[model samples]
Target: MQGQHIPTDAQKDEAALWHVKRAGGSMSVAQEGEFDAWINADPGNRLAYDQMRVLWAQVEEPARRMSTAMAGEKPRFDKVRQWFSPGRAFAGVAGAVAVGACVFFFNPDMVENIRADIVTENETVTDVTLTDGSIVHLAANSAIATDFADGRRDVELLRGQAFFEVTHRNGDRFRVHAGPAMIEVVGTRFNVDYLSRNTEIAVEEGAVRVSSNDNPQGVLLGAGDRVAVSTAASLGDVEKTDPTAIHGWMQGRLSVRNVTVGDLVARLDNFASGRLVALGDVSERTISGSFPTTDVVGSLETVAAAVGAKVIRTSPWLTVIY
Candidate 1:
């Protein structure tokens, strides 16, 4: 065999795109390590990927428009050709073409710009161990991106929820971020939910402080304390909650108390791959129970009975209660 030279930057770009093509779905923990190693092999790989992420974010809106326009008319991709100009400015022909391929081929449902250590799909509850020996139990449809560097441990909750059990160290802060808010602690067990159209933090042990962009003053939360921060606005006062009852989803149980029908449906639909649509006048009904997350449809039936509504299943993909 002849001797081979080091790969040029363009060659690394091609290889990085190859990895990106196969990414974004569920993979085993070991596979995630291999993938991370490949991405970290060269600075060129990361630089190329940064360009792709920018292109991906730019394509999202255009993709949405194209999908809406194609719903009634014959399928057409020609109109999108002119839109490639934005991507051209960020990358070369190869990179621009990669963006086009993803825009037309991959899942539009996955809008998360995934550059992370590990990812879990909808309806899954999996656990991950970070470099510093901390454990995170990830909830359904959630994504976590972690960076443990120097004297700090930083993590981002891209979407959905996660319960972090941190291991303490002197002079270092373990921080979990959701939206614009940060939950900092020396060591503790806590859950963060980003799926409720806001950020919710509930602590089961130790204590943590939460601060947001708009409300930088934030609040201190002790064990059994919970709080909510509306996106970028103010955070509500801390409230007390039962940790075992609230975090029972780890045991396949969905527990709640005095929540409205709409709120219940939203929680159920998180575990369901299908749509759970509620008809009129069902939003105000208060619900309290322990329903199994493994059987969301069954739980929906229980909700229907409690709220005096009928369960209607048109297909496995759609369920309606009214």
Candidate 2:
């Protein structure tokens, strides 16, 4: 029952009392009402509230003095009232000093506390094997972050795509985070395509739960299933597709299925040295085919031939079609 007695309303009241006093006075009517309601709603609220109050008291004086200096006002006991005002006090001393101290003191800690791996645009595909014996094929222009703390392994997909061949590790959950959605799995082979506007999760081996960051109860996907989370909307649509086609990137192929011609061209441009442009009437066209990943020029040619579009190589870094 250790977790059962979390916190209570009376404890939160006591904490709020301290916070208001440290802020130079008691809570306003609106704040007091809000605090009371919050405490009454949860049993553990009071304990958590008291802890926060203690933290505030520890940092209150330094935060206040720092705020005063930034506002061009001398730090005095009388002017302490200025630190309690809405915009001037909070913005000037409390916020500035706290943030500045964090930036100055905690920067090194922050850098050392990084929980992810990154691959830049100029970098090639990197191979990483997780502690669970799962292999991650991280594509170029992609990054994966993993926090192996707190008895869980959480990997975040910052950009691009990655093919995961996960090893079966019982009791250990592997989660992939892309945008506002998180793909959770115990042990499964999957491909996460996280382009600029489209976030696609395709499962090949085991079942995976694809849930929105905003609403975790929305949807779940199984093996041989794909879910597309759009950047514009919160609703995600699921579809059944060939898992091989989705995993074709591992074999140096860019597979497409009814994708926009513009999107296909963009994919080609990522691997190729020059920019690939779609001419008039080609941007709106839909393309369905597979292109080789290693051969960017060949992919462009294949796409151009399929769409009857011309690929004019303007420069090494730029190209135009018309």
Candidate 3:
């Protein structure tokens, strides 16, 4: 560590603010002068700024490729441009591409809108009554497709979360598919969340037979039971939970007992206009709160405070948490 410069928290925050302002658009004459002076003031300052810019580009690389691929264009970067200088056209293009990603890639509801039988936007919930009189409470930014045929009542949750109040039928089996996990129930009220790496199920009434790729035989979950199945279809712990809290989003509140900061942020991202990128491994920190689904930014700030972290708005389309 002798010849290296480590940026302090203050330095990092200043660099992040400067990057956001510069990426916002062209800077005013005086603002540009101030930025140049601040960045040139110390070797560590320049290092911090460059690090911020590089982090932005790295996180955006996937989104850029996704956008260009959809447009039938190749993904390329300006190799000669300095990462710290936000005035580069490359930065502007990347930001614009990120905006497109927010609309198309990150927002799965939009990508799957055509194929989904039911979809909900952010900060909104919708109730749909199926052919068999079963009711579904679709959460914000969620999508689902249904098929009822041959004595089979199937619902595929393409993305996000949903609560089902299934009605009983004499010879029909009601089943829900989320990622690699499958849940079957005759008549029950349950919640299923299709997360980034797992599909979670919480039973509020009656019982459900849950199976995943790892556990093909499946496990039976009754009232007040909750379980998470990994993307690989492996089962997680079957724990006790409050039935009311299981589908709390339907009431416009998110209640958690001991959720990790990362998981909380992931839920908040569904409501955010852009993205919430956690800078470090903040998973060890956990928080318990009942956040308002309508005020996502406020809930995010509360979560950050509980985890002893900072929230930096790096751009209109990106927020970095540390």
Best by lDDT: 3
Give the worst 10-residue stretch by lDDT in candidate 2.
72-81
Global lDDT of model 3: 0.73
Ranking by TM-score: 3, 1, 2
* TM-score of candidate 1 on Cα atoms, chains taken together: 0.64
| Residue ranges of candidate 3 with Cα displaced over 4 Å | 1-111
Tell me the TM-score of model 3: 0.71
Question: Which sections of candidate 2 miss by over 4 Å?
Answer: 1-116, 120-124, 279-281
Q: Residue 187, candidate 1: how far off, in angstroms?
A: 0.2
Q: Give a tens-digit lDDT track for model 2, residues 24-88.
A: 33346886787678667665665556565555455444544453333211112322222333432
Compared with the true structure, all predictions reach lDDT values of 0.67, 0.62, 0.73
Lowest-sum lDDT 10-residue window in model 3: 72-81
Better of 1 and 2 by lDDT: 1
lDDT (Cα, 0-100) at 180 in candidate 2: 73
Please, what are the lDDT tens digits per residue for candidate 1 over residues 62-82? Answer: 544554432211112333333
Local error of candidate 2 at 8, Å?
A: 64
